[model samples]
Target: MSNPIMMYTEGLHTIPLEREGIRYFVSSNSENCKNGLKLHVEVQPKDSPSRALPNTQNVVAAEPTSPSGSAHYGHSVILSILLCVIVVLAY
Candidate 1:
């Protein structure tokens, strides 16, 4: 309600949390963490989504893929197919 708490030591990000209690550290470099944003995501009474995660074991995160240096897929697939056809015909 007052201000968002610092969770991660790096990056400018905001996360909302509410619990029975929590603990945190205050330091000079970590001061910017205090300025992170806050959002309230509370479960409503008789909510269903809370049943999904208990031990949090049922969730798996898909890692973000780094972009390949070239536009590897969009054009190369067509070009390779055409080249293969040309090679077969020339033979």
Candidate 2:
């Protein structure tokens, strides 16, 4: 084990991770464990080599979108109003 690496994903994706000479294929839908996010590690025999899948088509990356300013401001206003209401009710 090493220092934890943080990763964020917006949709279904597969991540390839190698640790301690073992290869792991982790899916986004995998379950979490107490030790942190769980990894589905796959160990290959020392006599055999890892194989790569062949791709028949090219892949394109999607463009990232910026957040809207108005949406953020609206959220802040709602949160502030809720906090004020909570304080009033507490008294």
Candidate 3:
């Protein structure tokens, strides 16, 4: 029997399907497994032909105007440092 490639859902899982040619596994019902759910998986064999993504760069929004769009890298760094200081003080 051929071993199927595994993928994780909300937890660790091992698929029993094999990768040969263009194969797809889709599940819309949950009445067979212990997880009470199913997944849709697609597999392409290593030798299968596929389209390649172009190397050209796509335009992205450089200037963020909304609060959700703003990057908060500095805030995360400050929070990390604060946590480290608190941990050290507690020791």
Candidate 4:
């Protein structure tokens, strides 16, 4: 189960949770969250079996845009490779 409350931005969402007077913020998106950590979750206490501990995970905000917008370097490299292959095949 996940938290129902979330603050959504253009490419990310932030989920806030509080435990033992401490606040934790977890930032994630559909792309990064698939292979990475979850939004916000509670940790189990090792000392106390009856108490649930808070896992404080801070997610750094990523730069949503580059100089070329959402285009990545790998995409350009792949396109260049394809163009080279096409030219060589045509010759």
Candidate 5:
């Protein structure tokens, strides 16, 4: 399968992803993502609308919580994989 095209922009961005039999998208803003070290992940069904309507209740802020040791490790691994993906795709 071909990978999706991703454009690197200055503000909030959303990327669609599918795993196993599940479909979702992840949205993140570099400026608001802990200096690009973290992501503001949002998941929705494939049938749902990708863009949130203004003043709609579809958008919900994620609850803030401290990451455990394992969570930190997972985040690091994810970051590494993301970096590798970017490098490979850029070529």
Candidate 6:
């Protein structure tokens, strides 16, 4: 078996099921796993491949309206500090 890719970063869980004599492990995210056990395998509509859902908590939201003209001032200060650091390193 190859290295299993982690589906969930937290609350990792699995449910074992036998479909057509094939044992399979499904994630806790599935409806069957989410809500109690499903007695039989039901045909599901063809679904688009799943994509990783990003965590909103980790997403950095854009600064809600940077204080008017503060951007230029912030940039100038950062640049000045960077230049000073470079000069000090050079010496």
The clash count of every prediction, one per candidate, is 0, 0, 1, 0, 0, 0
Candidate 5 regions off by >4 Å?
1-69
User: Cα lDDT for residue 67, model 1?
Assistant: 88
For 12-40, candidate 2 gives per-residue lDDT tens digits of 56554433354533334444543366555
List the global CA lDDT of all models: 0.57, 0.60, 0.56, 0.59, 0.57, 0.57
Per-candidate TM-scores read 0.24, 0.30, 0.23, 0.32, 0.23, 0.25
Write one digit per residue (lDDT tens) for candidate 3, span 1-87: 124454334654465557554444433333444444444456655542355555758788889667663365778888999999999
Residue 26 C-alpha lDDT in model 2: 38
Show where candidate 6 strays beyond 4 Å. Answer: 1-69
Report clash pairs, candidate 2: none
User: Mind giving the per-residue lDDT tens digits that candidate 1 earns over 1-91?
Assistant: 2253533456665443445344443433444546753333444344387566565655788999988967658688889999999999999
Candidate 3's TM-score: 0.23
Best by lDDT: 2
Q: Candidate 3, which segments miss by more than 4 Å at Cα?
A: 1-71
Tell me the tens digit of each residue's lDDT in model 5 across 1-91: 1252454647665554553343423334444544445333445455546564566566788999876779758978999999999999999
Scanning candidate 6 in windows of ten residues, the lowest lDDT window is 16-25
lDDT of 6 by residue, 21-81 (tens): 4333444456666666433355444445575455536767887865678765998899999
| Higher-ranked by TM-score: 3 or 4 | 4
- As a TM-score, model 2 comes out at 0.30
Candidate 2 weakest lDDT stretch, 10 residues? 18-27
Please list the Cα RMSD from the true structure of every candidate, rounded to 1 decimal place.
12.5, 10.3, 14.6, 8.9, 17.0, 18.6
Better candidate number, 4 or 5, judged by lDDT: 4
- The number of the candidate with the highest TM-score is 4
Off by over 4 Å in 4: 1-3, 6-40, 49-71
